[model samples]
Target: MLIQLAIIGLLFAVFPLALVLISKEQNKFRKLIAVTLFLTFDLIIFGAFTRLTDSGLGCPDWPGCYGEANPFQAHSEIKAAETLLPTGPVTVAKAWIEMIHRYLAMSVGVLIILQMGIAWWKRKSMRHSPWLPTILFVLVGIQGAFGKWTVTMKLQPIIVTIHLMLALTILGMLVWAWQREATQLVLKLPPLLPRLLPFAFVILVLQIALGGWVSTNYAALACHDYPLCNGEVVPQLDFEHAYTLWRELGRTGSGDFLPFSALITIHWVHRSFAWVVFALLASVAWLSRQQAETKQLGNAIFAVLLMQFMTGVATIYFSWPLAIAVLHNAGAALLVLILSVLNYRVRSSAVPVS
Candidate 1:
């Protein structure tokens, strides 16, 4: 099964590998990094889809479906499970979804391994250090461990949330590494902009964490109203249970069924903190737009911010439709990607150009 899975991963990576090899660009290594980053972005999006559809346990195992390399081989087992619980998490369709997500993740791991190999081989001539890819390799390994725990632990809320956050962290790191390979831009901006960009990045990370908490806990509809949760300025909440972090999916620390008030707490905190994220990020975007070098990226940040806000509200108003919720997750990843680029540029500007 492991060999078959390895072969499948190689097959999935072939197209991107071939693209890098055949590209006319002088730096094939850099091209590979960009392609890996693009696929990582897709992986994060598809990961969201898998989670939103409740397919995380479709295979009921790690790295394969029912000890097989792909869902087709596990059809009988999946069918049996589905027959037993027709609306359960182990349906044939969900098995496929979950396995495909695993396949994509493995392919990304394969690509990163290739990146590390190439970086080491070309270390002398390469402009960027190889250590970043090495670190990314280690991070992907840890992420894969979390992926296993996500299933083995029965979609434990905290474990799942950390998995989501780790994926985004890898994405952000790739963005930073990729940007470092690009032509350096030195912008003479107001002193505050450089300081603000990193601060904004930190704020965004916290908001994403809170957002992950909301999703993993299935609290999207806890309020069922916009701007005002449950039709009140401040709904009754149980933060003690909501933020416990070490419990099961829908149970409190004491193993009782989690209360509606706890879900309300999770949803409300995420929704409320979003305004702070928006204000800070939007201000950074507005300030960035004033600079000639960063204007386009600033515009993109502003646009995604609006899209994120709309989709976030729509998810509540529309009762968390799968597509919109997945898009909301994608938007968050996109924001991370964009902010990574902006932060890299802003920080790079500080280096005294020789």
Candidate 2:
């Protein structure tokens, strides 16, 4: 089964590999990086879909569906489980969703491995240090570990939230690595802009983590009102219960019923922090627009920020439609990518003059 899974992953990975190999780009290595980065973004989005659809437990096992490579091989078992609990997490459709997600994740891992291999093989010719890809390989390995735990641990909110954050972090790191390898870095901003970027990045990441926590905890509709949670500015909350670091999906740390207040706390914190993150990022965006090189990027950031705010509100107003919620996650990922680029451009040395 393991060997079959590996073969399947390799087959999925080969398309991108073939593209890199055949591309006419002067720097095929960079093209490979771009391709890998694009796929990682897609992986993150699909992961959000898997979580939102409650397919995280569709297989109820790690690395395979009921110990088989594809859902078809495990069809009987999946069907049996579905029959036992028709509305539970193991329906055939969900099993496929979960298994397909795994396949994509495995494919991304394979691509990262190839990335590390190529970086080392061409170290002398590569502009950037090979260590970046090496670190990314290690991070991807860690991500796989988290992926396993996300299932084995039964979608425990902390584990799941960390898994989501780590994926975004890896995506950001890849963006940085890509930026480092660029042939020419045209974007330039004032010194203060770069200095402010890291702080904004940190804020954005924390906000994303909180957003993940809200989703993992199923707290999206806890309050059910936009700008005012539970029809009150400061609804009753149970932060101690909600913020407990080690607990199951819906229980408090002490295994008591996680109170409605706790859900309110989770929803409220995420909503409140969104404003802070938006303000910080918007400030960064305004500064970015002042400089010629960063204006476009700043504009991109502003656009995504607005979309994020809109989707966030839409999720609440529309009572958490799956598409809007998924788009909200995509918006978060997009924000991370844009901020990562801004951060990279600010920190890296000027693009070499042509």
Candidate 3:
């Protein structure tokens, strides 16, 4: 019952608005993609918030809560469960959060379907490549599968991390498609740094993967302090438990409760590699400053990096407040977008033949 309503609500919320955008916009295709990409990024950030808040299992059911599409519809069930367990995962608030996440996910999927429909209709147009949207359609489909797998598999760390990587991949692809439409083939790169942009993307991808791992593994509080963890020089390590595969989402290989040390391991790795990522982004921004089209993108990346850093510190000092955590997620997604745009601008914007 709740699933049906959520699906209907999502279609109404997303498809109709996109149709309106298609009809009213001068560049309907670009506007549609822009809006979809914006929403996708927002969804990813909210997913992070959902996970951070332990709302991943709030509904404790996939696509619905207690077989209801939305929380409101499942109020009775949620209340019953709350009464029975008292401290269980099926509270009304949690069910609402989880269902809202699902609703947003479905809405984004609807937008992608619209994007693909429009792309197919305009397939014959000489200037646009329909393949980009087509590829995004396929990617979104896979992302949906991962979304289900993430829930059904009990939020397996690997599955959740892969889901995150998929989201970033979708963001990059959309930016690429948008760039292809926005820019003509006349873009030329500065001769000094032809290879830098792609390299920067590679670095960003690695860092983003680590960030996903950190988030999925619940390592955010592994080390509550900055610059050092646990007031120790190196911090007692537990890579075996930290990197154990095929274990429960938050458990260790030996079936013992995951220790703070293991969390510290995950957190430290993310923090340590961040230095390298920061240097790489700094270089990319510096290099882009030398180019005409990417100058603004580079500056934006630099600014977002600073904001991300501040938010990271705030999450620590402020005891992982929800706003800071959500903002950190947003900042991370924006960094991905800025880097993605910079990548698209540098890659697709034609370069002089050597």
Candidate 4:
């Protein structure tokens, strides 16, 4: 089963690898990184979809479905489970979803390995240290471990949330590495930007973490109204139970069923902290727009921010529709990518070119 799974992962990576090999660009390394980054972005979105669809336990195992390489091979077991519990997490569709996610994750790992190999092979000619890809390689392994824990640990809220965060971390690192290789242009920006960009990045990461916590805990619909949670300025909250990070998915630290107030607390904190994230990132975007070199990225940041806010509200108003919720997750990732690039540009601007 493991060997078969390896083959499947290699097969999945063939298309992107071919694209990199056949690209017109002179910097195939950069092209490869870009492709890897693109797939990582897709992986994050699909991970969100898998979670949203309750497909995390679709396989009930790590790295394979029912100890088989693909869902097709495990169909009988999946069907049996579904028969036993019609609406449970195991089903044909969900097993496929979970397996596909795992396959894509493996393909990404392959790409990162290729990246590290090439980086080392051409270390002398490359401008940056090969350690960048090496670091990414290590991080991807850690992310994979978290992915396994997510399943083995029964989608423990903290584990799942950390898995989500690690995916974004890998995405951010890829963005930073790609930017370094893609361009060397420097921007002339206000002094405040260098200081503000990192602060904004921190704020955005915190918000993303909160967002992940909400999603993993299935708190999206806890407050079914927009701008006002359950029709109150501040609904009754249970911070004590809401943030017991080591507990099971829907239970308090003490093993009690988590109260509605706890879910409300989780939902409320995510939504409320969002404003600070928006204000800070919006400021960064507005400042970025002032510079010609970064104007497009600035505009993109603004657009995604607005889209994120709308999708976030829509998820509530529409009662947590899957598409909108997934979009919210994707938007958060897009923000991470854009901010990474912006930070790279800003920091490069400060450095005196030798």
Clashing pairs in 3: 2-68, 2-69, 3-69
Candidate 3's residue-wise lDDT over 176-260, tens digit each? 7776767464555565455776776787788878877788887888787888886875799888888886677778866788887
Candidate 2 per-residue lDDT, tens place, 39-157, comes to 99999999999999999999999888888999999999999999999987899999999998999998899988988999999889877788989999999989999999999999999
lDDT of 4 at 1: 96
* Model 2 misplaced regions, further than 4 Å: 186-188, 350-354
How many pairs of residues collide in each model? 0, 0, 3, 0
User: What's the TM-score of every candidate structure?
Assistant: 0.98, 0.97, 0.91, 0.98
Q: Give one digit per residue, the lDDT tens place, for model 1 in 36-126.
A: 9999999999999999999999999988888989988889999999999999799988998898999999999999999899889989988
Note the Cα lDDT for every prediction shown. Answer: 0.92, 0.90, 0.78, 0.92
lDDT of 3: 0.78
User: Tens-digit lDDT track for model 4 on 93-193?
Assistant: 99999899999999999999999999999999989999989999999999999999999999999999999999999999999889889758866787788
- Which stretches in model 4 have alpha-carbon errors above 4 Å? 351-354
Model 3 lDDT-worst window of ten? 183-192
